[model samples]
Target: MRYNIIHRTTYKYESPVTVGHYMARLEPRTLPFQECPWHELTIFPSPIERAERSDYFGNTNVYFEIEGSHQKLEVIARSLVEVIRAQPFDPASTPPWETIRDSCRSDVYNPATPAGELTFASTLIPVGVPYADYARPSFLPGRPILQGVCDLNRRIHRDFVFDPKATDAATPVEKVLKQRRGVCQDFAQVMIACLRSLGLPARYVSGYLETVPPPGVVKLVGADASHAWVSVYCGEVCGWMDADPTNDVLPSERHITVAWGRDFADVSPLRGVTTGAGEQRLKVAVDVLPDKD
Candidate 1:
């Protein structure tokens, strides 16, 4: 399947005086099952200096600086991508969850291997007794890793409510766990915390998910929004598998990959700093449309 994605962000400052610098991780990734042939980032009141590079996690990042003062700033990213659905596999066929945990524990530390690095705590995700206890039920002794992960994913979906206003980027994982309500970001972080607490490698993924309308209903432009999910390291043979606890299913063609890291802080879609600014109003609109050509 082919898709055209548009993400637009605008910030209006009550008082603008000086410089601004920003970093964007909005480019779609190219994976074995995904291809991005075109992409472009447009900034209003073009920056004085801009550069592109790959981050520690191999994600494409764009950095730009604006020296002139302005009351409004707009950043838009457009891309065309093709995604192939992964073939389904039996979760029971995966190795035991304990074995994978042990392997991560015993393996030598290697930054080149993200799976090992991801097994420990990160900025937003914490590993503690509470998280391990919460995840222990699904990962009983000798349970297949993927099977246990899937069960945990389903349990989260069944237990939590998707409330957009319940949490913010700074909200701790412990709070989300206690409240049992949040948007996709909260669910993904909570799941990551659970897996990492048990010595499992799980990364936070940021991207877009196609939202289909009801039968015979026309899709609304800008109705789609950014999405977050988790990717588990299932072992050498099976490799990384994406799971959407927010939707309770394995990601497929409908899920477009953007960037991933230990947690959302590492791969936030957009982050920046301003030299002088007062109250700010921000607006974001996203569209993920099927492409025909």
Candidate 2:
């Protein structure tokens, strides 16, 4: 499946004063099952300086700086991507959850393991007893890791309430678990916490989820929004399989991956420090349209 995605972010500030620098992680990645051959970023009040670089996790990150006074800021990104389902994986055939867990905790001398780096707590998610407790029900003794993770995914989908107003980016996982409410980001983080607390390797995924309208119905422009999901390392055979606890589905052609990391802080689409604009209002509009060609 192929798609054309447009993401627009607009910021209107209360007052204008000076300089601003921003970083964006809006480019989709090309992996064995996904390909991102073309993408672009457009910024209003064109920046005085800009550069692109790959971060520690290998995600494409672009930075730009605006030198004078500006009361408003606007950034837009466009991407064309193709997603293909990978080889079939058998959850029951995967190694027991404990095996992969141990591999992830191996020695520092071991060849750098991406899964290992994600097994512990990070900037936003912290390993804790509560997280383990929440995950224990699905992880039975010697259970195949993927099988157990599927159960955990469904449980999260069934348990939480999606409320955008309930929490912000800064909201902690502990609070979301307590309130049982949050957006996709909250669910993804909570799931990561649960996996890590159980000594398993899991990462947060940020991207776009295609929203289909009813048959013959017109699709609304800018109706889609950025999405977050979870990816668990189910041993070496399964590698990373994407799961969307928020929507209770495994990511497939409808899900387009951008960047991933230990938590949202690592892959936020846009973030930066500005010398001006004391207070600001942010509006984000996203459209993920199927490309006819």
Candidate 3:
């Protein structure tokens, strides 16, 4: 499947900002099952400096600075990408969950290591007794890693509620766990914490999801928004597998990968520091359309 994606972020500040530096990770990833041929970014008030680089997890990063005073800021990112569904892995064929978890603790850690770096706790995702207990029910002894994780994913979707107003980005994971409600980011982070508490390697993924309206209903422009999911490393051959607990499905063709890292703080699409600003309102609009012809 091919897609033309548009993402726009607008900031309306009551007080003008004199200087600002911002970074964005809005480019679609080029992976074995996906290809991004074109990408463009437009920022208003034109930055005084701009640079592009890659992060530790290989996500494209763009940095720009605005020197002059500005009350409003607008950024537009456009991309063209192609994605194909990879063949599904047989869950029963995968090694047991315990086996995969143990390999991540090997004494020698390197690029070739089995996801040792991701097995530990991060700033946003904390591994605790509660997390392990919350996930243990799904991971029975000798169960296939993928199958076990899928059960955990289903349980999250079944138990929690998708309430946009329930939490914000800065809301604690414990709060989300207790409230049992939040957006995709909350679910993904909660899952990551659970997996890490179980000594497994899991990462946070940020991207876009194709939202199909009801039959015969026209899709609203800008109705789509950014989405998040969790990726678990299931041993060597079965590498990173993505699961969306919010949707209770393994992400595939309909999910467009943007960036990934230990947690949402690491791969946030747009974040930075600004000087001389008070009271700001943020607005984001996203559109993921299937390419025709």
Estimate the TM-score for candidate 3.
0.98
Best by TM-score: 3
TM-score of model 1 (CA atoms): 0.97
Question: What's each prediction's TM-score?
Answer: 0.97, 0.96, 0.98
Report the lDDT tens digits of candidate 1 across residue range 160-264: 999989998899999999999999999999999999999999999999999999999999889999999999999877899999999999999999999999999
| CA shift of 64, model 1, Å | 0.2
Each prediction's whole-model lDDT (CA): 0.92, 0.91, 0.93
Q: Could you report the Cα RMSD, in angstroms, for every candidate shown?
A: 1.6, 1.5, 1.2
lDDT of 2 by residue, 1-293 (tens): 99999999999989894888899999999999899989999999899999999998889999999888898999999999999987657779988998888787777544326678788899999999999999999999999988898898899999999999999999999999999999999999999999999888899999999999999999999899999999998865667888899998888889999999989999999998988788899999999999999
Deviating ranges (above 4 Å) for candidate 1: 107-114
Model 2 clash tally? 0
